[model samples]
Target: MKRLFKSFLVCIFLVSISINFNPPSLAEPTSPYIRYWLICGPFKDADLNTECIKNEANLSPVAGQKVDGKRWRRFLSCEDKLTFEKDEVFGPYGNSVAYAYCEIYTPTARKVKLYLGSEDGLKVWLNGKNIFTNNAVRSFCFDEDKIDVQLKSGWNRLLIKVSNITKEWCLSARFIRRGDADIKDLTYRPAMLYQLPVKKVEVSSVQPTEPKNKGMYDALNAIDKDRSTRWSSEFSDPQWIILDLGKPKSVKKILLNWEAYAKNYTIEFSNDKKNWTPVYSTDIGDGGQDVINFRRPARVRYIKVTGTKRGMRFGYSLWEVQAFSLEDK
Candidate 1:
């Protein structure tokens, strides 16, 4: 019929060029998990205008976009300044408490200053003294400079520094140590409106018999005695277990079993005792019981369970270790 109608219009022009050049996998919608603090370059000094004036004058942005979120900006270049050596320590609210409320983002706007130091204890300032000191005693000192500061055009100078370093507690703080085209961004929300509800103690079964050291007896025989642990089988290596929430509590939901095996694991969160942060992670590998939901709720005393990947072993076994506060609602 005329070459079959030109072969059906060349198969409709090759199906409209394959539907406009292959476009069909679009399902990327996941945005819910914000937590930030630390609004300044915690410094020991390599001098980049004192780490760009503590990362552009203590910029604050607890969440994201909103009159520049929290505010502060003025330090452009030298690669923004982010260095840690003398033992390394960075926690501007990534963990470690002292006072909360975070969110900052200063794309532009200058005039900033704030500095703090510690090795034993710290207390800082900027608008209250440009610089205020506390017991500081680990040795790199810089406290005493509260000048005529004013930054406002899109997030100005708002300083605050606190430190506590005794032995291996190296503390460092910086802001507007210098300035130019500043860039300070931070936005974290979900402290549960400043959460404060954790007083429900009663998890004592006195069980501690399973340590033959096959990595602590496969993590104490994969949880029992009310500490809970499971995988059901399908694990090759990489296993971990550590819990000591005997004090500070205020967690939410973290129940996993992933027995059957598919692969995926990463859950780290710590307090004092050392310092670790991963929050919650999973691949769900089609195993089994897996629930990890938290959008800003954690007070932790200590928790660690590692397993980067070892699936195909079918050795997943963890039963019960439930924890919930805030009236367990």
Candidate 2:
């Protein structure tokens, strides 16, 4: 009986050890991630900081080092940083809402190392532990080290310090999640909003013609004697050019150019010319020449071009206008 009791106790001990030895998987929760607005900074402007803190309710001061003459700081809470001048906001999942990935772009020639810091720009932290020290101007960049650890399924705050010693200060950051909602769905739909008719211009084709310029019609018929030097007729104004695409399709890019400078003009599209929606335009510049990249995902048959300020005549001069469908390979 003594031996049997001893064996039973040993078995119990072994079972207890086995239960404690293996740990549970950290990824048990499978709910979709939530989207959070990221905000940052007052730095030189205390008023901005106060407003951000009020709006976000997650403000925290980060400590940082001084590299060169400029002072730097890192904030864990999104409420303390400034919006990126360009490409500021992004998601982890390539514009989707699933995987969480964030990157920052900084303009500086020198190599930079980042760390998290505290108030008065003196403390630093990494992976929840303090590390490194320096005094330099902080610039923004895509630092893999700064984000590798803090990233999780839901909203995550990334704090980083940048050092710049090369050129003028310019910084930008972007964050995205993998499984987020498709931006294409939340796209701007003209039908939902009341909008005025916007003007645009389109050139069908431009070919080499006779030296005497009689506009687009003259150039199409003119023959080129010298193969090297071809007479090209350019169309200056269209008031607005309309194209019948025949069927609704996805447009990836649009290129517009005005031979001479034209005043206020806008680009619009529609299924029928009567009701139109503006897609691209220019305020004031050399002619109305521009390449517009739009994120609007929609189907339409007609594209209307219109002029806003009519006194100043502006028309598009095109060698050719081409529309392409986006493909995934």
Per TM-score, the best of the predicted structures is 2
- Cα lDDT of candidate 2 equals 0.34
Residue 277's lDDT within candidate 1 is: 71
lDDT of 1 at 201: 20
| CA RMSD per model (angstroms) | 18.4, 24.7
User: Which digits, one per residue and each the tens of the lDDT, describe model 1 over residues 1-329?
Assistant: 99999999999999999888843211122222112333333343222222233343343433332231232222111111211122122343221212212333345555555443434444443323334445434554443333324444443333444343322333333444254222244222222222222232222121233456233323343344333443232334555555665665545556655433436666666676477777666665565666655543465766665655656654434553344433111
Candidate 1: stretches off by over 4 Å: 1-105, 110-217, 220-242, 249-283, 286-295, 300-310, 317-329
Per-residue C-alpha lDDT of model 2 across residues 1-329, encoded as one tens digit per residue: 99999999999999999988854221122111111212232122222112222322222322232322322232111222322221222211111110111222223222223323221122223323434333433444322223222232332333333222333222222222233221121111011111112233333344344668434342222122222232122344334445555655445455544443435667676776677766666566455345655443334566655544432332333332334333110
Clashes of 1: 47
